[model samples]
Target: MTSHHNAPAEGGTEELSRSLTNRHIQLIAIGGAIGTGLFMGSGKTISVAGPSVILVYMIIGFMLYFVMRAMGELLLSRSGYRNFADFAGDILGPWAAFFTGWTYWFCWIVTGVADVIVIASVYIKFWLPTIPLWIPALVVIALLIVLNLPSVKGFGETEFWFAMIKIVAIVALIVIGLILIFTGFTHNYANGTATASFMNLFTTGGGFFGGEFMGFVMGFQIAVFAFVGIELVGTAAAETKNPEHNLPKAVNAIPIRILLFYVGSLVILMSVVPWQNFSKDESPFVMLFSLAGLGAAAHIVNLVVLTSALSSANSGIYSTSRMVYALATDGDAPRPFAKLTGRKVPRNALFLSGVFLLSSIVLMVFGLDKSTGFSIVTTISSLCFMFVWTIILISYLVYRKRRPMDHETSKFKMPGGLFMPYLVMAFFAFLLWAFTRDPDTLAGLIATPIWFALVGIGYLVLRRNPAHQAARAAHLAKVADEQANARAWQDQQLNASR
Candidate 1:
């Protein structure tokens, strides 16, 4: 394959087809933002934060929008900002790139593992309800890897449908929820005031701040999950037909999606059934569907959850490969990952990433009995994604400072840039605190450093390799020599003119 680095000015990707359309982009945003997290765990979020989860969703949605806006501005400001890892390195530094790139790659690989576990555990019921979880987990890992190898658009198309399945399910659920909410169709056995009304959002979530400030703070847990892939739209910046136009359109659509899907759905759920009673044993969507007495509703919602996990893993792989591709191009990762197929897909990097994704299965094999291990992996994925998110915000800070003129002209400038960045930073730090406080999420926080330690060790080992060391030295020396020559040429030209 010809080097994308030197390819004609038009298209840059080699392995991926430009088969994605506006509908695809819209659904990608829709599919990504709403996932298993919202359908399955949102009930838990509402239970914890009460109706204030609405505010939680709103607040997190608002802040994450800035992150996307920052990503959009940086990408549009320069063609070089193809992916987040590349943008981090260009604006922040090589270390920033190395950290962001590898960490993000690890983020998905870890997340894919979690998805595998969920699939094997939940979907096994369809065929052999008695089968051990590990058996199905292995099958899923192999199946996903095979599917991913077909090429990016194939992956995109599959994900499009996977996402479509999820989107359709949620949209249907929302419609049904709205109907029950208006018609008082839900059983009101205990709660006398379960009739059609709007105050249910406030009343059902265990009366606002269920406990106190702590209860409100706990809401972030569920809020964070709902917003997990909120930045997913930005990951497709380079591949989209017209990024600047589509990216902002994608970003701006978040509010409506959050409103109808998250805020709207939650309103109906809590309104019908008090949020306090929901749990992992029961999903609010499933509960509502069953309440409607819909035939095979549990099975239907299970399929939705299954689709959600698969979509999450699918997005994870795409993002992981891109991170590897970006790092390879920048010389942070091995050059082979930089290889792209004629269709503009990073096949080599993708293949290499597939190899790493097996860690999830391996994790499932040994950790099946240990819920602790599962929790740790979950937290680590969250922490790693959080780290990646923070770097994006920081990269924007550096980008704006480094190029005020370019930013001024940027069509997608981040609003309230300086102040908002600080506020978001503080909010993130508070999230870190929340992680420490929550048992379910704490394992992940503890697990992340150990994961990073291995990455750091790998980086050091790679940096020490003789061939790579020489390449680094040569690249640095070439850059220095070029700078020196430019300085000398400037002086000579000035003297000659004088």
Candidate 2:
């Protein structure tokens, strides 16, 4: 294990600046975890799982909490580690880093492309019904690129406010829902009149699990998508101020966020409107607001969902660029991606990610229904994230065995130690089984291995190049020296503190 005192010095000349404050880190963490999945997809999930969707979220959240904890401890263990890939390389070997890094990059690219398409389509409906969808899609890609070009701080500020809107909306929903539930507000739906009450959740059509266990199993696919970006804070550790303090604070807040934002809001939505009343064709949020007699609720929710898409797209850009930059620095990607701008932003990397985001325009040109396109892309993204999470857990197990001394002495160690990683792995295996149950997710699961094969082929080709071999050797040497220095410094700090 490398000492935390040894900051990375090999690529010190072109590193991202630590301008993101504690507040920026907090909201960015929140922003990354919450996406269109909760706002838009929840309607379909509720329609399928009924009130049992609450249990689905809680179970997923409970398992992922350990994943986040494992990630937190890994990042804080070494100051030089930029993201999961860096630690994966150091602990697991170069191959782990290569695959994990590229896979994560691929995940965000697909997610970003899907998000911009959604954003553009929403804009066409709400503000520019007359315009072609491609125009707005191009404009959105351009706008986000400009927003990210300035610096890391600019990205942080944009995400902070974008996340605030989501937070405010959920809080408002929960508060208003409590009032409605207590007052026994009754709203007539197409099927029947639903009186707002706690019992409404279980009384509608059927009781918990909707009297069909398959419905509960089906919700697992979309529910997993809702928690896709929970590990994003681990990626931001290198660019955060006082990460040892801020990182844990952000991670510890995950349970509360899930409880309040996910479970709490779903309970409110179902209680206010019976689960059977939610339409798979529309957002449950819009339905709840409209049921409360808000005339423009559709438009309002449209705007909110639009911003949520943009926030997620923005995050995709930020995380992918950083990952690419890290890969380049390690000689695993094109050298240009490692070059930093005067403001210390990875401009080239950001531009490269933007180029892929333009592919969303191609989806529009094909005339696929926007909803269908989004569903396919999101399924692929969710499956890819599962791979990334699996790698993180695998790396954690290795870290414990290889660095027992560090694990015993570390301040931010994962609570469950050896047992937790295996438990989390088992849960992920169940998710894979759940994926096989649905044809859509099953297609994604089958298609995912082709991506790994492509990456493996690329790795083999890169390994044969003399220049690549030389670069890898030099990079490894530099990292080795840096780790040694870090360990020495950490020993001094320990002695002094004693």
Candidate 3:
């Protein structure tokens, strides 16, 4: 059996420190679960899907819970695994690691770009009506880069406070909503009127399906976007302190959070204002606050949404840099990206990600309307994220089949095992189908394959390069030796204990 000393470093000698604690992990998970999608996109969903949007959120959360569990189990199966990409390579091949790592990097970069642009637009329109869009966009990019340049703990702390703001806001909404409901409050709008009552959900609008089956389908699409960052907790597993304990706590709490933050808020929003009164272009949170007689409701909601965008962009920068660092270490990307700073931060990889994030400025320069540009970018980002999710499930299936013994021994095994992965994949397939139903989403669907094709071609080209061939061979040897050593140690412990 190979010794741990024989196991080569997968990324490099410099490793990401386990600085994130249970508190940090918990808040990061919550922060990821809540994003601008819920703050800004929920209005469109309510307008489109009526009261039934609640079910869409719940269903998406349910499926993604299993996906997160799969990821948690995979990360725990091996200590050397940095992220899903590492395990994908170990179980699948070098190509799987390359594709998954780069695709995840691409996913967050696209998401970051979209987020900064949205933040800029929000600032210009709401507070500084005279500023150019590109100015604020550039400033936000710089701010996020500086914030992430320190350490993983800094990122964790920033996300913690950012997430706290959102949590408080949602909880406040729920509390106020319950108060209004109990006091028999009523709100009248131009399109429709509603009262603070449970019966308002079905009786006022088109009922559960939201007047048309197509609306429900469209709700599924938007709701999928809202949950885009839910798997971020898995990404943080390697950097987490005591991941075995913290990871499960974060994953288990998802259902309760989804019910309260998402489903509860929607139910109250519809009860107070009715689905018909919601506007596609406005935020339901703002509208609900206004209905409750808050004069500064729009401004307050804008600030919350603005912070939400910044938090998401911050997460994008962090995730993308780490992913690129993983790719470079594995010889899938340029060697320079594998370099780390004295603070243990992936500076080179972070710089590269920040460079891509600056594309948002170029997007702003194009002068596309805020709503139109946002829709296009988010659709593409959502598509890329779906691809990442599919890879995780595929990797999980491969793990279960090839490592049955590992599965049997795993303390944090996925609940449904094979059935859950397949079931989740089917749900993803349905979401993809739903995408094809809308023209905007269909455009995104058409554009997504082009990226995969490019990555595939790049992989083929890299395979022919002598340098990459050597690096891949060395990495695989290290992985094999490491696994052997791990097994040897496990057997030794078992024998000694007996």
* Global local distance difference test of model 2: 0.83
> Which segments of candidate 1 are over 4 A away from where they belong?
1-19, 186-193, 204-206, 369-371, 461-498
Query: For model 2, what is the alpha-carbon lDDT of residue 218?
Result: 86
TM-score quality measure for candidate 2: 0.92
Ranking by TM-score: 3, 2, 1
TM-score, per-candidate, Cα-based: 0.87, 0.92, 0.93
Number of backbone clashes in candidate 3 = 0
lDDT of 1 by residue, 1-498 (tens): 012322332224443345556776788898777868788778667666777777788888777877777777877877645677666765665567678888888878877777877787666556578887767776776676677666666766777898788868878887887787778664654445355456655565357666357767887864675566667766676677777677788878888888878787877777767666666557888888887889899889888888888888878878787778767665567777777767677777777766776665666567562555666666677777788889989988976665666676788788889888788888889889988877867866766788778877777877766644554555456446545665676687689999
**How well is each residue in 1-498 modelled by candidate 3, as lDDT tens digits?**
102211333454567879999999999999988878888899999889988888899999999888888888888888778788777777777788888888888888988888887788774469999898888888888899899999999999999999999998899898888889899997666865556887888877677666488899999987887888888887787689988899889999999999989998998888777678788888988878887889999898888888888889899999988888777766678878777777778888889989998888887788763665666667888888888788888988987766666787898989998698888888988989999998888877888888899999999998987756875676578667656866776687789999
Distance from true location, Cα of 22 in model 1, Å? 2.3
Judge candidate 1 against the unseen true structure and give its global Cα lDDT, from 0 to 1: 0.72
Per-residue lDDT tens digits of candidate 2, residues 394-452?
98998776665567677888889679888888888888888888777887788888899
RMSD of 1: 4.9
lDDT of 2 at 104: 95
Give candidate 2 regions above 4 Å deviation. 1-12, 466-498
